[model samples]
Target: MSTTGAPPRPGPRPQGPQDAGYGYDVERLDPRGPGRMGAAGPQRRRRRRPWARWALFGLSFLALAGGAVLLYVFVILPLGFGTSLVAFTAALLPVAIVLGAVWWVDRYTPQPRVSLIYAFIWGAVGSVALTFVIGTPFTAWISPSEPDQVTAQFLGAAIQAPVVEETMKSAGLIGLLIWGRRYIAGPIDGVVYAALIAGGFAFTENILYFGNSFHQAQAAGEVAGFWQTFFLRGVLSPFAHASFTALCGLGLGIAAERRSLMLYFGLGVGGLSLGMILHALWNGSSFFLPVDPANPLGGFLRYYLTVQVPIFLILVAIVLFLRWRERRILRRQLAEYGRAGWFAPAEVDMLVKLGARRKAEKWASRHGAVARMGMRDLIRATVELGMERHSVLHGKPSERTRRRERELLERITTDRRLIGALTAPVVRR
Candidate 1:
């Protein structure tokens, strides 16, 4: 919007009389008035926001994306080749899809594009590269050193993997906050972003593991172990990254939001340490301190997720409750702005409830698709605009912030008028 300068205006000139001088009033410029100022200079080129600053996102995506492909091709392909590639691909589908969705959602805001791109790269590339180098030896060292042959595999499966994998998986989330500080928000964002990266890593890794399972089945001359492991990894473990990464995210998020530097560091570091402990406990849960000499740990592989699953669920419950609280706080904040006449009471009510918002959009849809979409946008924009108003009440918003808010509401509310409906007129001065 600042790309164009308004047209110059003529001012009245005054000559002083001997006895008294008269002051002249010059009309102030009206930005929206149809004329040179409105239509000619700033409007023609209509420069977009400094979205150009984020154009680098495209390049980051390309560079990191190629790396993901190469890793998958060389590492994952070999692992799956011995068995059935189809099973690997099938198991990978959900993880891959969820990762992409998370990536897309993070883009909706003017977030630090590099931070997000790095998050993906850190997980898919950095974390993977670390684990491949670190995990191979742990496997070899532990392989022959199991409990009674009956429980040896469980020790390697439970204790070995969690200690090995969770540390590797958590590195990306930590790297993101340390190196890419611009994008990290509260615990919620930390979880979501970390989970995305972890999920992406897990998905790619799962394909390889599943593929190897198939290959091992071929070696054993068994058909069922491949599918059974495939089902377990594909269905059960795709969400594992999301769960584990969320713990780290929660820690980073708490630290990010804290005003006190000491407290922030302490809380965040504590949370991350807790996450590591959780990972160890989860991995080792399969074999508790063994009561039987035949079993190194008591429970074995069956309890790895089962033990951690409840903790993950509790974390999820806490996250949901926190999110609901945020939504309600936002709703209450916006409803107060309705008192200023910018929004109608009905509109505020609809914005506060998901169901009310949906019904309002559905009602608007009978007129036209564009109208319905516009109304939906209007409601959302109004809520956001009201929030911006609160920020403005406290301090001056930059021109870009103001322009963006105006543009969003204009696009939405304008469509509502064109559809022969008006939700509410602008508030009176």
Candidate 2:
């Protein structure tokens, strides 16, 4: 972990670096090696070929670009830009809703914005493109020579769609786990990232469905089909994809904590399988449910109420539990620093409690913009510090983590000085 010179004490100032008058040695707080750079620092050297990594990056960029081109040509061009624009506009509603839900869950220890954007783009573009490439052939291979429309739709939605789409979406989660492992501390982070990717996928998929419906309805001189599709997908089941993929994220998050490769793979595969099963179940239900000619959605509504609603509720409860676990970890980890005099107990309470933190920010905002910015930085650094300490307490310690801790502590120190308006929050019990 990182430690810095404590704030000035009431008595005389400490004489040396080791004795900053906190009653504890700053060096002792961080058992890791010092990062002080002397005058004669080592010179930078150019590295030799990192060809494999660069090749992978290039290939990925090319693949996504190709996918975008295919999407524009095959999907968007067929619908025409005007129709696609209308679909895109309608799709934004559900995207905003999912994003808001993810943001609320990710309020504590938020992941990097760049990483979140990558996940979203991969879900929207890369996964959709992969689905086009793999799903078309696979569906053709499985379909009978003389296929009926109903059978083909069932095969595509219940079997092929679930298998293909979930696999493609899960790939984004796997990539994040492999490349952005440091950002994923636990299941909450996994769920949040997975939800973002699923959200993006849902957004793109909605545009296609919405566009198709609108075009068909326009040709028939009726808006019923388009409105019906929107009601089903947009109003009722906006989070369906997110719910399914979050299972995979939950698994990958648990996988992140494990050192064993087999265990990690096992858990990840398990989560993906669960997500696929739920997706298939959801898609297949429409087929099994009896549809009345007068009331088309009678059975569908019953299934949604009985099955899908419960599953969504259970997922919500699990997320709440995970968030509570995060709060517990923050309290446990920061309490050690609080005891060491690096943080006041009230400050720790403020960091863990969103209500208290909000109040503090509101207070800082009354002072000035600088004070507001400083308060935000202070809260963020404090959260990161707790997470860093938690990482060290677990078996994943490294020098890089220590360096990050030092950097975060330095940030916290600077922010605390700037945020002089709010020292310790008067948190409610």
Candidate 3:
């Protein structure tokens, strides 16, 4: 009788290019033959696409055009009011604060500087311009000839502005998901990108609001309007747009790491919807629960203590959870790569913990800046390799994925060699 036992262990399966050792020599295993570039050949060609440069040029032109329009409206037009300096200064201070917070949060694995700047420009110029264009006509059309102040304000704040502004701000995140998907590794990336966009949007919006407040205050012969507006928009609610857009960013980030089209679409829609709803609630609060105009500060305290403060705390909790998840991902994926021999087990331990990573940087700093930078690059490449592997296993791997994997391995080797060479002299001395 034919035996049903497991066939005598077959000869070891032939190692393909990917199964080759994680060293520079692994290129010899390329299925395209020893001299050919293999998976990276097509990626190099794709990177040279002529359309990308043109697209970048188009975006730059749009940003410049939008900025010109906004400058006319917010700065030049309001010049006669005599508060241009105060308005610009007030607008920028909060932006600086928000940017500092964002940079600190993204210290572990910062996204590309160019991508971050693009997000900010999209929010500041493109989104703001689009919103102003659409919202002005819509609001004007909806207003009654003899408008009631309460109803007009309620509709504009609760319905019109939230819908228009959130939609416009989210366009930037959507663009990133489409064109720069690789940059968003997790929810934290999304939050960072969203925060940059929100900061930019707030910057431009503040310029307009502050300028208007200055003009109105001068017309009424009172300086208090400018300060009151600054206190509310600049100090108290500068992060309002960021917090709202972060919900959308969180959704996009989750979707980027997933493979299912339905899940992606659902998360994107849900995130945008949630942001709009929260924005509406915040804006509508002023109308439903009218603050006593006589005691504006007291009313603001009451409203903030009850509503905005709680929402801010919730956002803080979400950020902490996302940061924890980032650490967990780094640990789990690097451990798997360690087993596969891509990383030393000890190296994985150092890379996974923030304290260990910092210690490593300090050690490298003693060698020289070149060694320090090499150490940093090695750590980043190793982390990226782990993330790429995780993404491939969880979703569908692409040609770009293979190329990236190969590039990261090469980078890790080069960086390590550089660091070793730099430290070798110190050790001998």
* Model 3 C-alpha lDDT per residue in residues 228-321, reported as the tens digit of each score: 8988898888789999999988888787767557866898789889999999988887765656668867866788888889998999899988
The list of candidate 1 runs beyond 4 A from truth reads: 1-53, 80-84, 93-126, 133-186, 235-238, 255-264, 286-298, 301-306, 364-369, 379-429
Lowest-sum lDDT 10-residue window in model 3: 18-27
| Worst 10 contiguous positions by lDDT, candidate 2 | 31-40
**Tens digits of per-residue lDDT for model 2, 1-55:** 3367876557633433221222222332432222221122354444546576556
Kindly state the number of residue pairs that clash in model 3: 0
Output the lDDT of residue 95, model 1. 75
Model 1 scores a TM of: 0.63
In candidate 2, position 341 carries an lDDT of: 56
Please report, as a residue range, the 10-residue window in candidate 1 with the lowest summed lDDT.
17-26
lDDT values of the candidates? 0.58, 0.80, 0.77
For candidate 1, lDDT tens digit of each residue in 1-429?
355788556655443221011112223243322121122224333475556535555555676677667776777766645354665566567677666556543422224445655666667676676677777688667776544764666655665556666676666666556543445645556776777677767766766667777777778998787776666566555566667667767777666644345655676667656665666565554345445556533443446456656776797687777566546655665565445333455656777666777777786677678767776666656655544443344344445445655565465456545443433324523
Q: By TM-score, highest first, what's the ranking?
A: 2, 3, 1
- Model 3: how far residue 255 lies from native, Å: 0.6
